[model samples]
Target chain A: MNLPQPLQELIDQFESLPGIGRKSAAKLAFYLLNVPQDRLNRFSQALTDLKVKTHKCDRCFNLTENKRCSLCEDEGRDQSLLCVVEEVTDLLVIEQTRKFNGLYHVLYGRIDPLNNLGPEEILAPQLLSRLVKEGGKIKEIILATNPNMEGETTAMYLKSKLEELRTKKSLDFKISRLAYGLPMGASLEYADYGTLIQALDHRNGF
Target chain B: MNLPQPLQELIDQFESLPGIGRKSAAKLAFYLLNVPQDRLNRFSQALTDLKVKTHKCDRCFNLTENKRCSLCEDEGRDQSLLCVVEEVTDLLVIEQTRKFNGLYHVLYGRIDPLNNLGPEEILAPQLLSRLVKEGGKIKEIILATNPNMEGETTAMYLKSKLEELRTKKSLDFKISRLAYGLPMGASLEYADYGTLIQALDHRNGF
Candidate 1:
C-alpha cells in the first residue's frame, strides 16, 4: 500500500501478536503514531524492560527478577505445598485471589498433541527432578493446570510420573488436583478471583 | 491487583491509549510481553520512528515527511481541484481509489460546537484563503468531510463561508460537497474503497 516503511514495520510487528489481525495492527500503529511522544517513549521503554528485566525463576519457571520467585522466596508462604500451573499468568491469576500462600511451579505451556507438545515440551522432567530432590520437605503437590483437554492430559501424565517417582524414591508427598468447578475450556485469565479461590480451597486429591 | 511493577507499568501505558479499557489494556500488555524480544523491539522502534519521521505537509496538512505532500507535488494531479478531508487517514483512503488526481487538504479535525470547535478549529480559513489566492485557475473545492453530525455541520459552515468569500473576493470557483450515499453515522474508516470511490464520483455542488 506504499505506507511509510516505519508504519508498515509497526503494523507487521503488532500483527505478529496473538489474536491481533492486520486491520487491528494497522489501527494500533496509527493510534501509536497519534499518542504523545513521552507516552510513546514510555511504551517503548516498557517493552524493553519487559524483555530485558524479566527472567524465569529457576525453581518455579515463573517470570521473576530473582533466582527464586516471590512465592518461593517468601518465608510466610507454605513451603510444604506447591501449586503447579501451566503458565506464569496463571500464577498471577491465583495470586490475585489472595488465598493461595503456597509456592508454585509454572510449566510455561501445556501438552498440546495437535502442536506436538508432549510432557517433555513443558518442562515436566525439571519439575519431577525438583520434586524428587525435595520430596521430604514438600507435603503436597497441587495440580492446578487449566481445565481443558490438554490440561487434563498433562495433569494425568504428571500424576502418573510423580507416582512412579514415589514408588522408586519412596516419597510420601500427597498429590492433588485443583477442583474443576470452573467452566470447561475457560482460561484462568477470565476466571474471577473469588471463583478461583473457591476452586483452590476445594481442591481434591488426584 | 498486585502485578509486578514492570507488568503494571506496561498495563498502565496500554490503558492510556484511546478506546482501550482496563481489561483490554491488560490483555494487550500480556500480549506484548509474550511477543519475541526482536519483534517487540521492532514495534517499539516503529512507534518512535512514526512520531520522529512523520510530519504534516506544509501545503495540505496531511501526514508526510517532505515539505509538500506526494499528491500536492505531483505535476499530473489536477491543481485546480482540491479535496478537503478531516484527517490524513482519509487522504490515504481517497488516494487508494486512484480515481481522483486532485490534491488534498487535511483539516486534522472537524468543527464541533459542543467541543468548542468553530471555523478556526479546522482548516476552513486557510482553505478559503488558498482558494481566493489561487486566482481563477482553481475550478472546484470538494468538501469531503466525514458524514457524521460534526462533518455535516463543518461542511455547511464551510460552504457558507466560501460563498461569502466568493462574493467578497469576486472569485469564480465552484464549491462542492461530497455525496453521502453510504449509511449515515458510518465513519469513512469502515467504508470500503469502492463505496468511497463511488461517493467521491457522485459529489454535488453546494
Candidate 2:
C-alpha cells in the first residue's frame, strides 16, 4: 500500500480505536481525506480538547471542567440520595431516564480482580470519604453498578464497608442495590436463566 | 446526558465518519477519553496532517505528498501501458496484486447522471490531453473501471473518446476493458446471470 505518509498515519490512528480494524481504518482514513480541510481541523481540535478540557469532579469523580460536576453543583437535585455507578457513561444513561434527580458517584471502573483492577483503582476510598464528609445529609446510597460479576462484587464490598461505617459513626443512611429483573421490550421466552431467576425472585404484584 | 462539551464534540466528530452511528460514536469517544493524553495528541496530529501534508498527484490525480505520485514517478514501471481507474482506492487494490506495473490515471469518480456527475468532474479532459501529449509512445490503455453500471458507462464513454482521438490524431494506442467473468473462488451456482453470460462470452482455452 503506497499511501501517503499522512494518510497512512491517520489510518494507523483509526485502527488503534477499540472496534475499528485495519480495513475499516483505511476506509475511515479515505473518508476523512474527502472532508473539507477546516472540518478535519475541527475534528483534530476536538480530539485535542477532549482531555485538556475535562477532568474528574472533586465530589463524584464524573467528568467535568470545573472542580465539581454540574450534577453535584445543582441544588435542586436530591442530595439525600447518591447513585454509585461504574463509569460516567453509566451515569449518563441513568440521567437520560429523567427519573433519578439525585447526585452520582462515578467509580470510573469496576473491580476486576483477575485483571488486577481492585476497588482502590476505581476510587472506592474516595467514595467512602465523600460519604463520610456528606455526613447525615445523604440518607440513602444506591449501589447502581452494573449487574455483571465485577459490578456485583464491587457493590457487595461497598455495602459491607458502608455498614461498618454506619456502626462506627452511628450514621443513619441506608445502602441498597438496584433491583434485578427482566428489561422492558424483552420477551420472557428469550430471557437467560440468570435474568429469569432474578425476575422470579424480585417479582412485583400485577 | 451531562457529558462534557469537548467529549460531546468528539462524539459528534466520530459520528460524522462513514458507518459510525450515534451509539458507536459515543463508545469511541469514551474509549478515546481513557487513552493517555500523549496518545490523544498524536491522534490529533495525525488528523491534522492528513490534509495538510497530502494533495492530488499532478499527473494521475492519485493522492500524493509530491507533485506526482510515486507510481507515476517510478521509471521502472511500464510508461507505455496505462490503467484507468475510478478512484485511488481501486488503484491501490490493483497495486496490491503486483501483476500490473503500468502507470494509472485516476478519474476520481465515474459518470453518474443521477448525481449530476459527468466526465468534466472526473478529469476526463486531463486524461485526453495527457494521452495527446504522450504522442505515440503509449501503446495500450486498459479501462480498469469497475464492472457496475456507472463504471461500465464511464468505460464505454472513455473508449469512444480514445477511438476518436486515435483516428483524428493518427495515434496508434490500443484501448481495452478488463475481462468480465465469474471471479475466482466464486461458485458458479451462486454467480449472477450477468457474470455467467460474460464468462460464457469470454471463455478462454485451457
Highest-DockQ candidate? 2
Q: Pick the candidate with the highest TM-score.
A: 2
Which ten residues in a row are the worst by lDDT in model 2 chain B? B1-10
For residues A33-143, could you state the per-residue lDDT of candidate 2 as single tens digits?
889989989999999999999999999989998888899889999989989999888998999989999988988888999999987888889888887888888899999
In the range A92-196, model 1's lDDT, one tens digit per residue, is 889888999888888988999999998879989988899877767788999998877899899999999999998899888899997656667878899987668
Candidate 2, position B133, lDDT: 89
Report how far off residue A179 is in candidate 1 (Å).
2.5
Q: Report lDDT (Cα) of residue B176, candidate 2.
A: 92
Chain A TM-score compared with the true chain A, each model in order = 0.81, 0.96
After superposing candidate 1, which stretches have Cα over 4 Å from the reference? A181-206, B181-206
